[model samples]
Target: MNTSASDPVTDAPTKAAPIIEAQGIDKLYESFQALYDIDLQVMDGEFVALVGPSGCGKTSLLKILAGFEQPSRGSLEIQGKSVVGLPPSQRPTRMVFQKLALFPHKTVRDNIAFPLKLAQVSRAEQDARVAEMMDLMHLPSAYATRYPAQLSGGEQQRVALARSMVSRPSVLLLDEPLSALDVKLKKVLQTEIKHLHRTIGTSFVHVTHDLEEAMMLADRICVMRHGRILQNGSPTDIYYRPADAFIAGFIGETNLIPVQMDGAAFDNPALRCADPTLDEAQFSPGHAGTSGLLMIRPELIVMRTEAPDAAEVDCVMEGSVEEFFIKGSSIQYRIAVEGLREPMIVDVQGTATPPATVAQKVWLSFQRRDLYLLGEG
Candidate 1:
């Protein structure tokens, strides 16, 4: 799996210094600890996403970065300077909240120019900067005189992003800014935000619970749970090489078959590995015990009417289709394999010939190269 965070332009390892350095950070609400020893770094011009369920300390960490809430412990530096005690206004980062916090009464131009105005920039400079930002955001000059209530949700989002970028901060923090938009508009703005980031080359630290959104937009994804960072790596690493089963299930639809590994072979009676000489590198590191999970992506498992040849595939299982869902571009099946409590999921392309039906016996096969071993923890 590719673990390195690559630069968006060159697709190579990023050599830029971290624009935001947060080490051993912790946040507490009196006796209740909201965050643990959280250490994160946002590389210059990199986009990182903080993703987890609610109450996972993602928002707390963002608040600490924005200086809205002080950390109970640890150090934070932006551009190599400490910003722990600084106010939000004094910090060099701009945040676009979930609600967008756009001034409803103000015109688009005034809303985008608010940051510049607060910085005491000259009016002429503010106008020029606002105009540049509007052009960059693809907002026409005619819309500049309109209020937020008059503009569409997507347009309001663009205005919020423009306001955040008007000051040209080294890092732009987004707190689920697209959560409220509809699916279609959210996708549109997601593309626009990605393009804007590429165009401006500003570091972005976006916090969201949407895994798909994170995978789509972030260069590196940080998975958090119980106020701690569970995993941090490139999207490929997180998807194909998840650290644990929780992350595996969180990323997408998958099948995690419990297996006992005895040396280089699985001892589970329900599983059959055609290849006896499977490499140990296929297993996750630190899996000391004889137990682990065999992770197979839904799309990787092929449903066959006849048993596949042992030489053709590494693993094979016999199961009957318990249920199925037609997902437009793909067909998802729940296969009931004996000795397993949950049904195994398999996804076939919508274009594939002859979809499987419920109660039909099918052979599920996947190659060793496509299988990933995850620690049972």
Candidate 2:
């Protein structure tokens, strides 16, 4: 289910209390406001991703959470205790930066043990903990004596993670830690990070602009825009049931067909629904008697040589293929429908033979239940 006004999405039967909570948080840099009334909660062991375009205040929010920047106006809590002005060192959190900020001159072991040494932990305990972290991060024992420059990018990332995690903080804040890596390494580290979170059971609050990364790594995603959160929910909810047109167009390519809402049905001559009588529930909330967009994902649209069985599908439209793209796993087709201004996108699984050629007349059909109504706003 979609969350309401920044409320945390509760997907489990037994909910865990939040390990980090920010209520009505706002931030300002002199005359420019950077964040709005933001409410967020990270449950124990939950992975939450703050995602948006650059300059959307996600990093500002992350800094606030990490105690690097104080919220201009708001209440901040950690594990049920107020911590608005607490310093980063005093807070029960650690941050892994995008640059993987490992000390160039220090060996891996010394880097991992730095926090413990700062806390005046005994030499024996420091050694034990650093050794344990090295093993946990899958770093070789031999690499402990090597400097940051001696390790590969992925290995250096592991060292940075180990350093942040060695102190056993309650929450781990990641600020685009995987953004600099190549695609293959990013995917490998993504899996490793997910596995590490599951293994350690620590709360992770990751900030990133990559929607695909957020969807893959996070238990819940908060999509932000222009210093405010637009929607926050599970990946499936955000993908299929976006709040508005901007959000529907954010994550991936989608077809948004304009239609006027007439009571319980869409009043568009160009569109056809299998069920003439549509329930009010089929429409988006607060959009009756007004213009709206019908959202259809590219992969959900089916291409047919002949007319589809009207009883089996809810919506059907005839269009001619204007362009086609050969994606490795799927073929993407741009079809020009008479009533729509832009070409409709459809993704079909790759096959030995193409489904339809350019300029070929094709019928696009999709089920009603798969469709979502979205407001233009």
Candidate 3:
């Protein structure tokens, strides 16, 4: 089908020097390979996220970069210097963990100043840096003497961030720092982290299993699968133009309908109700095949009681609304078809004119570009 990935932000196509670069990276545990030929680059001042399910090697890759673990084979460089064998403290990077790892007995000022102490900075410098970090994190200086246990979760997070940044590392490593918080707190921290990244002007390598968090925090995302990078791109690229079937399913709720491909054109009895205005012959013969999925996002599906204006839309399909759900700002309709085992989910604005009701016939319309052709796995 016609390629239709939304370009949310057009960043530089290349950089003079990457902040961190890993080449032919591999990690093995006893004979089990955890990562294979992992090559990636983090540009200066960019936020890159490593995302995948459990045991997907995202954590391993992060550890390798942070010097907590060494790659079995590869070259790693930070700020144009090779850091393959350097310790975490020696490398130009810092890590923030999920548990915060803040000393419960230590006050906020002491916690943030811990890094300065390790570097043997003068006490005057330490106090000055600590105050600056607290100010940057928006933590009141009055709370400087309070212990981490006395602060709220968000406050404690700010302290953890302050500790990590006080060292002035060029690269900051975050291992699911926000995953432990509740949804609301997580969202607040997400914005705070992004703002902090911008203000600090440092490259950030964040690791998380939460896809939405990565989408919110990362300028670029590396999707891993079974110890391999599956796709790497902007959020728009990953969501709208997924590289393959697995990414399409993993990134969001999608409806995969089986369709028959006739040469470069899609042909199936199910497509008969589609509007003629759609660019039907969008696919090429080289990638033509019957064992493929017509991938459509639920939000893109428009349900109506009457046929949509053919000229104003693309394709339209006939189905019956079998189930209905009221989301906060959107309504979900489960439309049933003759051959499909499960219903197709169609999402529409909650305030749409004459919404669909359960057990009612409805039409689903969407653009031709919205029709993503993915090979069935």
Each candidate's number of clashing pairs is 0, 0, 0
- Model 2 stretches with alpha carbons more than 4 Å out: 1-15, 276-281, 286-288
Across 235-314, the per-residue lDDT of candidate 3 in tens digits comes to 87787777777888888778877777654456546655343222533332223455567778999877779977877666
Question: Which pairs clash in the backbone of model 3?
Answer: none
Cand. 2 TM to true fold: 0.92
Model 3 residue 218 lDDT? 91
Clashing pairs in 2: none
Top-TM-score candidate index? 1
> Candidate 1 on 314-366: residue-level lDDT in tens?
78899999998887798889999999989999988886554778899999988
* Local distance difference test, candidate 1: 0.90
Q: lDDT of each structure?
A: 0.90, 0.89, 0.84
Rank by lDDT (best first): 1, 2, 3
* Cα RMSD (angstroms) for every candidate in the order listed: 4.6, 4.8, 6.0
Deviation from native of the Cα of residue 165 in model 1, angstroms: 0.6
